[model samples]
Each structure stands twice: as C-alpha cells, then as structure tokens.
Target: MAAELMDGKLLAQEMKEELKAQVEELKSKGITPGLGVILVGDNPASKSYVTSKEKACERIGIFSDDTRLPDTITEEELLSHVDRMNRDDKIHGILVQLPLPKHIDEDKIINAISPDKDVDGFHPVSVGRMVLGQETFLPCTPHGCLKLLERYDVETEGAEVVVIGRSNIVGKPVANLLMRKDKPGNSTVTVCHTRTKKEDLLTHTKKADIIIVASGFPNTLTADMVKDGVVVIDVGINRVEDASRERGYRLIGDADFDSLKEKCSKITPVPGGVGPMTITMLLFNTVQSARNRLSK
Candidate 1:
C-alpha cells in the first residue's frame, strides 16, 4: 500500500478554525492580536510569501502592519523600522522577511527585534528558549513539522529519527524539538548534513523510523535510504524547470515522493505540505504573543 499523505493544508485549515475562535475571544476581552511584518526587498518569492501571510492574518481577524522597503535600504534604516514595530502597543508579533539585500546585515536585524515580538522566532533569545524547552515562540517551519507529526500520531517517543539538514531555521531547531523531554519528543535524533560521508549518511538513514529532510536540494532522500513503514517529512522546496508547465517550473521536496511513497508509511507532499503549515504556525505564534500581552 502507498504511504498515506499527511495533508498539511487540511490540518492548517483546522488549526485556523481554532485560531479564529481564539481571536474572537481575545477581541471580546478587548485585545486584537496584531502582527508587524517587514519585507526589506522586492524579491518575487518573498513578496508572495508576505502576501500569503497577510491574507492569513486577515482571514483570522488578526491585525497586520506591513512595511515594504526598497532593496537599497541600509541596515540602520531597517533597524529603525524594527525598533518602531517593537514599541507599537498594538503589534504583538514582528516578522522580518528573510533573504534581505546583500548590503544589509541579517543577523544584526534579527537581533534587533525584541524577543517578545519575534514572531518569526529567529531572534537569539527565542533560539535559546527553544533549546531550553521553555515556553517561547518556536520557529514556524520546525513547529509546523512537529505539529504534523503529533497530529498524525507518528509515535515519536524513543524513535530513531534522522534529520537530513542542520540549518538553524528548520533542521537544528526541529532536531532539538524532537529530542526534548516532552510529548512528541524524547526521540533519538541524528542530524545528517553535507559533511557526513555518503556511507555514514546511509547508515544513519537506514535505521531511522522517522526522517525530516530540509536540505534545500531536490531528491536528497529516496526510498532505499529509509526503512519500511517510516514516517517522512520533506521540508525542502526547490524549483525544477519544466517546460511543459506555464510557470516553466514546478516545486519538489527533498524526498523522492514517488519512490518513497511506495516504501514509507507516511509523507508530506510539496506545495501543499509543509508550506501551508508554516504560514499557519506563524499566525499561531502571533496569536499566542498577543495573548501573552493580555496576561501581562
């Protein structure tokens, strides 16, 4: 039998329905959850992502303050905008779109945002809190992946899980989350990366009951690499040129879904998989941040 599709789009809709009720209740209590979004350049993909986030915020009745800046803006100018958002009483969560212009310092900008309002959860404080397993904003993509595993009953406890990337954003954070001493955690995680020898990589993957691949490269994981009945989360999204399509390209994940589907017990598809959940979780963090403000 083919692997069951872990439909993130459906789950995101369900989560949004729950969030709508939470937002309504917060409004009844005189608190409107607000998100301040900053986009530093006009990269088409980044713009599209930001637009989706704004739409998601609107759908759930959360306030969004969007700032679109030119590619020429200096690091100092961007920092000023971040500082402005930090002090905005109505804005509970702040998100700065990634891949800023070459001239700007990404780390400095991320560090400038207040941890309390770092909805993207890229700030150092948030990372530290996540490592410590404290209640803090979890990185959206990683958080979404973990949520999918939990909702789908993936049996993470003590599972041999291999994560195929080590980036701070998805791989590292998700690995940390999986090993935490908590439900949906307590799994033994081995993270494979570019540095891992080919044989060593296979050795780790062959025994993994669960694998989360986020290497940003297509076909990083295949059917032969994972065990039968494995649960796979494909986090990589790479565009491959396809002349037959109108857009001239298609999105694919790191895992070879066709081959892997026949072997693995479960998997998440590209485009409709982790992508939707990432945005939904961003909205989740924003709502949670607003609720925190209300309690303060």
Candidate 2:
C-alpha cells in the first residue's frame, strides 16, 4: 500500500482557524496582534512569500505592517527600521525575511529585533530558550513539522529518527526539538549533513522510524535509502526545470516522493507539505506573543 499523505495544507487550515478564534478573543479584550515584516531588495520569491504572510494576517484579523526597501539599502538603514519596529507598541511580532541583500549583515539585523517580538525566532535568545526547553518562540518550520507529526498521531516517543540536514533553521533545531525530554520528543535523533559518509546516511535512515530530509536537493532521498514504514517529512524546496509547466519549472523536495512513498508509512508532499505549515506557525507565534504581552 502507498504511504498515507501527511496533509500539511489541511492541518494548517485547522490551526489557522484556531488562531482566528484566538485573534477574535484578543481583539475583544482590546488586544490586536500585529506582525511587522521587513523586506529588502526585489527577489520575486521573497516578495511572493511576504504577500502570502500578509494575507494570512488579514484572515486572522491581525494587523500587518510591511516595510520594503531597495536593494541598495545599507545594513545600518535596515537596523534602524528593525529598531523602530522593536519599540512599536502596536507591533507584537517582527520578522525580517531571510536571504537579505548582499550589502546587509543578516546576523546584526536578526539581533536587532527584541526577543519578545522576534516572531521569526532567529535571535540567539530564542535559540537559547529553545535549547533550554523554555517558553519562547519556536522556529516556524521545525515547529510546523513537529505539529504535523502530532496531528497525524505518529509515534515519536522512543522512535529512532534520522534528520538529513544540519542548518540552524530546520535540521539542527528540529533535532533539538525531537531530542527534548517531552511528548512528541524523547526520540533518538541522528542529524546527518554533507560531511557524513554516504554509507552512514543509508545506515541511519534505514533504521529510522521517522526521517526528515531538508537538504534542498531534489530527489536526495531515494526509495532504497529509507526503511519500510518510516514516516518521512520532506523539508527541502527545490525548483527543477520542467518543460511542461507554464513557468518551465516545478517545486520538488529532497525525497523522491513518487518512488519513496510506496516504501513509507506516511510522507509529506513538497508544495502542500511543510510550506503551508511554516506560515501558519508564524501566525501562531504572533498570537502567542500578543497573549503573553497581555498576561504580563
């Protein structure tokens, strides 16, 4: 039998509905969650992502402020804008889109956001809090992946999980999350990256009850590499040339879904998979930020 689809789009919609209800409650209590997005340069993909985020905010009844700067913008100018958002009482969450213009210092820009308002959860403080398993904003993508597992009722406790990527954003944080001593966590995790031997990748993946691939390379995880009945989460988003498509390209994940799906118990699709959940988690984090502020 083919693997059951992990419907991230459906789960995201459910979470968004919950957030919308919470947003309404907050509004009734005189609290309106606001998200500030800082975009630099004119990368078409980044522009499209920002637009989608803004639309999500509108749906949830949250206020969204978008700051778009030219490609020529300097690091100092970007920092200035982040600083302003940090102090803006109306804005509870501040997200500076990644892949900043070459001229700007991305680390410095991420550091500029107040920890309380770092909805993107890229700051060191947020990372540190996550490490300690404290209540802080969880990085959206990894958080979303975990949520997907929970919604699907996948068995995580004591399971051997292999995550193929080591980036701070998805791979490492996800490993940290799964290794945590908590529910949906407490699993044995092995994170593999480029330096890892090819034999090691197969060795670990073959034994993994859950495998997450985030290497941004199309078809990186072949069907033969994974064990039967493994739950696969494909976090990679790669654009490959497709002559048939109108744009001459299509989105694909690291896993060879067509071949690997038959070998797995559950798996997520590329476009409708981890992608939607990332945005929904962003809205969830913003709602939490607003609620925390009100409680304080």
Candidate 3:
C-alpha cells in the first residue's frame, strides 16, 4: 500500500487562516490578542523556532512581545521578567523558549509563569488541569499531534496505539490525551520508555493500529517493528550528518520513512509534519488565552 502523507504544513496553514479570522473578530471588539516570548541565549535552533513563531503571530494578527536576554542572566532576573509580563494587561500569553542556559533552574522558571498566561502549558497547574481533562492550555507538540489526527479523520476509538516516549512534554500528555473518553481518543494506549525491553517494545508496537513516536532519536521505529496498515505519527526531529545536503546535515523522524512508508497506511514526515503543527498549536493556545480574558 502506498502510504498517504499527513501533510502538517497544509493543515497548519488551514488552522492559521481560521485563527486569523478570529483575531480580526477580536480586534473589532477592541481587543488585541498578545503573546510575550522570553528567549535566552542565542542557540541557533531555538532562535529559528522563535522566529517562526513570531512570523506565525504576525500572520494571525496576534501582538508579539519578543524579549531577548543574555545567557548570563540570573534565574531571579528571568523570573522578574516573567512577573512583569504576567502583570501586563496587553499580554495574554507568555512562552519561555526551551533549553534555557544550563545554569538556570528550568522548573523554577516554568513555575514562575502564571498559569493563565502559560501558553506553552508547562506549568504545574496547566499540567494538572490537563491530566484531569479540564480546560487548560495544552502543550503545543502533543496537542498538535492530536489535532493532526483529528483533522485527518483517523480512527482512534478502540484502536490499539503505542507511544514510544515518556517525556513530560510530549509523551506523557499525548498518552493521557489518547486514552481519554472522547473522539480522537478512547484508544487502547501503551507508552514505551527507556526502561522498556526491546522485545516488549516491539511486541506492543507490532500489534498497535496506531503508533506515535516521540523518541527524540532517529531509527527508533523500523519497518520490521510494526505491522502493515498501522498509522504512524512521528514527532521526533533529529539532525544527522548529510554531506549531500547544502547545510551538511539533514532532519529525520523517528520512523524509517523509506522502509515504513510502503507498509503503513499513513505517516508524517520530518521537516514538514509535526514541527509545523507544534508551532501552529502554540498560536492556537495564545489565541485561546486572549479570548479567555475577554470573557472575564
């Protein structure tokens, strides 16, 4: 069977168009949705990701307050910045770019952001609400994964699903989301982690009707490990050496696309798949945060 692409780029564009219209409507109501981003250091990949988010905010008519800080900034200084944004009436959402300098306490920074403006959904409060299936900002990557499956009309109810990761950001949330008693959920879910035995991991994967891979490494899902006709959503974004490319490197997903494409019913690609969806959902959550304030 020739596998069909999930086409996250296309779906993300559609979602952005819808959000743009919402932004216009909110503007007419004399409200401008705003997002404040804290970017520390100058990591190239993080900078690129932040730029993409800024462009997305512009496209959707959301106001962006992009703040750049030095790598030497103290954790207390970062928290002070977050505190100021938390009190800013114009800023409805706050996002701290990940992989902050090693000297900084990541959890303390994440905890400093108010739950109401925590668009990245890493705050303990947001995570707790999500675990209880309450209204809250969902983490962009996992939420984007669900949105992709929903938009593509994939069957999740009663389906056997294997998630190959355990990270709090993507794996834990997505697993909880898939097993919820709701559409695009209700799947019999199994999550494989680092401690999982190779044989056990393959056994769970081979029987799953859908496999969501966020293993953070390439080649985690091989063709032989899964059964034919399984649906695959690869969330991994790994950089590997590629002399043939102009940049001397290439981006790849967890699943072996070339070998698995012919076997799976549907699959998402590396550069254009989950990556785009993740950023798009960040925009979605920011918009939602702004809208929530209007009703208050």
Off by over 4 Å in 2: none
Ranking by lDDT: 1, 2, 3
Q: Provide the lowest-lDDT 10-residue window in model 1.
A: 218-227
- In terms of lDDT, the poorest run of 10 residues in model 3 is 179-188
Task: Estimate every model's Cα lDDT from 0 to 1.
Answer: 0.94, 0.94, 0.93
- Count clashing residue pairs per candidate: 0, 0, 0
On the 0 to 100 scale, the lDDT of residue 92 in model 3 is 92
Q: Candidate 2: worst 10 consecutive residues by lDDT?
A: 101-110
lDDT of 1 by residue, 1-296 (tens): 69999999999999999999999999999999999999987799999999999999999999999999999998899999999999999999999999998989899999999999988889999999999999899999999999999889999999999999999899999999999998899999999999999999999999999999999899889888878999999998899999999999999999999999999899999978999999999999999998998898
TM-score each candidate: 0.99, 0.99, 0.99
Candidate 2: C-alpha lDDT: 0.94
Candidate 2 displacement at residue 49 in angstroms? 0.6
